[model samples]
Target: MSGSDIAGLIAAGVFAVLVALLAVPIVKLGRVFDELRSSIRTLSDGATPLMDEVTSTVSTTHEQLKRVDGIAANVSDATANVSALSSLVAATIGSPLVKVASFTYGVRTAWSQREDSSRPSGRRSR
Candidate 1:
């Protein structure tokens, strides 16, 4: 009815209009937060399975590496055994074979020298 009362009413109406205008962006912000939450939930849901698969893959690789380590250890042991066996065979057979070969060479050399001495002037007819 008065000037001050009319001005207050106009101010309240303007405030209401401003609230209504700003509520559009607030509502849209709420919807964006909801979409972001849904996307995060979806990504977590997908990533759980991917992480499980990665865990299983790592477990499988660890198991395979353990098997490979065992195989490598066995190969190493076998190689050591082969090396020891070769050394044993060389010690057992190599010395006697060398002695026998040396004796054979000496006999052959003596025989050849005797035949040469029997020939005239150490020259063979051939």
Candidate 2:
């Protein structure tokens, strides 16, 4: 063979060996990427059901809170009604009771005065 042809053949063989050696790491890197993709898909699949349950729980909690709010409003209304009723009862009974108390006090004072005027202003026995 010629000198240039021999040199060219050696270069081609060296290139082939280098390519073969580099291919192993490239193949392993591809498999690692595939495994990562599979793990991500599995994680997403598991998360779907958990997210759905969380949504349902949140909805149930919101509904219960609404019921509690309604109960609180009802209690507030009842309290207002009770307060109004108490004020009405006071208006209906308080004035007449005051007048009756004043009348009783006047009667007692007049009777006591009459007894005192009929007696001397001396020490009286209890």
Candidate 3:
């Protein structure tokens, strides 16, 4: 063959080899795109159940918090009522005791004053 024809044949062979090399990367890219699609679908499927569980848990937590708040309010009200009841009981029971104590103290003071006046200051009583 002539030199120009041989050079043309070599150029055609090199072009074919470059095309084959480029085809391998194209096929690999197609597989990578397929894997990406499959992973996205799997992630989307998993998110549905995860979101449902989170929603249910949040709703349950809200209900429990409401119950706890109700119980706390009831406890606060009960504490206030108990405090008032204790004060009332103290007032009712303590007033009579205080009056009795004052009356006893006054009687003791009067008796002591009378005894002191009846005694002669320098004489020892038999």
Candidate 4:
């Protein structure tokens, strides 16, 4: 054979060896990409359900907060009603109680003064 044909054969052998050496890493890279795609799909599937559950939880929380607000309003109304009722009771009962207390104080003061005046100084009336 000629020198050029021998050199061409050697070049073809070297190129084939290089391609075989590079193919293993290329195939492994393709497998890694496939695994990554599968994991992404799995994560997406899990996240969809998680997001739906979160939405439902938020809806329920909003409803509960509305109910709590309504309860707070009811408590405020009850407090106002109780305050008005207490004022009404005070007006109904306190006037008579004050008058009676004032009359008792006056009677006690008058009786004590009369007794003191009727007794002599440094002497017991009894």
- Model 1, residue 67: displacement in angstroms? 1.3
Worst 10 residues of 1 by lDDT: 117-126
In model 3, the runs with Cα more than 4 Å from the true position are 1-9, 98-126
lDDT of 3 by residue, 41-122 (tens): 9999999999999999999999999999999999999999999999999899889989999999999999999999998898
On residues 1-126, what C-alpha lDDT tens digit does candidate 2 reach at each position? 999999999999999999999999999999999999999999999999999999999999999999999999999999999999999989999899999999999999999999999987878779
- Alpha-carbon deviation at 126 in model 4, angstroms: 11
Better of 3 and 4 by TM-score: 4
When summed lDDT is taken over every stretch of 10 residues in candidate 3, the lowest stretch is 117-126
- lDDT leaderboard ranking: 1, 4, 3, 2
Superior by lDDT: candidate 1 or candidate 3: 1
| Candidate 4 RMSD to the real structure | 3.6
Predicted candidate 4 versus true structure: per-residue lDDT over 27-105, tens digit per residue: 9999999999999999999999999999999999999999999999999999999999999999999999899999999
Clashes of each: 0, 0, 0, 0
* Reference-based lDDT, residue 88, model 3: 96
Model 1: residues >4 Å from true position, as ranges?
121-126
Error of 2 at 22 (Å): 3.0
Alpha-carbon RMSD, each predicted model: 3.0, 3.8, 4.5, 3.6
Q: What local lDDT does model 3 show for residue 46?
A: 100
Return the TM-score for each candidate structure. Answer: 0.81, 0.66, 0.64, 0.66
